[model samples]
Target: RKARALLVASLLLHDFHLRFEQVRRAEVLALLRALGVPRVHEDFIFIIINFSCFEISFHPQSWVVTSLVIVI
Candidate 1:
């Protein structure tokens, strides 16, 4: 039951992160456009945002799982 609760919490957090990312992406794009940044630069910024989101979502989980494996 604890595990199930954790799973549910994790799913909720993941969904929140995705929604936050979408809003953040929109805000950043708007800011860039307002500043008259070029299309190529906009694409680069988008890539960076994606990488940041990936790291935010997965890197800590990987570390925790690794530590658990080592402890076991």
Candidate 2:
């Protein structure tokens, strides 16, 4: 069915988006590890990852985003 095909495509797109985010988070944290930063808690890492994903959409270059990232 056409509807089913659309649903499958939507799901695949969502999965690809999640994978892209995971890649970005992995690269960011890997670079940090390479620079000798201490390992972060899983929850903290999640916050950073989520923030990184949204900051571009919402705040772009806002100081609020920068301050919150620093504070977290």
Candidate 3:
């Protein structure tokens, strides 16, 4: 259950990081790895490619607010 929760949190953080205007693809992968999101190193390149292909916006403030809400 803990691992599952960590996975979910990692995914959420990944999405949040992606929403940032200045976040680089490499940084995202690094964040995933730092968060221990399983297989990040092996899939880093592909993940970056896929994420970069998508049209997404990063809102840093929203991310912080949402994270605080989640914590509470």
Best by TM-score: 2
**What is the TM-score (0 to 1) of candidate 2?**
0.36
Better of 1 and 2 by TM-score: 2
Candidate lDDT values, in order: 0.35, 0.38, 0.40
Output the better candidate (1/3) by TM-score. Answer: 3
Residues 1-72, model 2: lDDT tens digits: 231111111112121233323345565456446645566455655666665523322333322222113223
The pairs that clash in candidate 3 are 19-57, 19-58, 20-58
lDDT digits (tens) for residues 5-72 of candidate 1:
11111222222333433445565555445545433245544664654422243443231111100000
- TM-score of the candidate numbered 3? 0.33
Clashing pairs in 2: none
- Cα lDDT of candidate 3 equals 0.40
Q: After superposing candidate 1, which stretches have Cα over 4 Å from the reference? A: 1-23, 40-43, 52-72
Over 33-65, each residue of candidate 3 has an lDDT whose tens digit, in order, gives 686555544354455344443333345443221
Total colliding residue pairs, candidate 1? 0
C-alpha lDDT (0 to 100) for residue 4 of candidate 2: 14
Clashes of each: 0, 0, 3
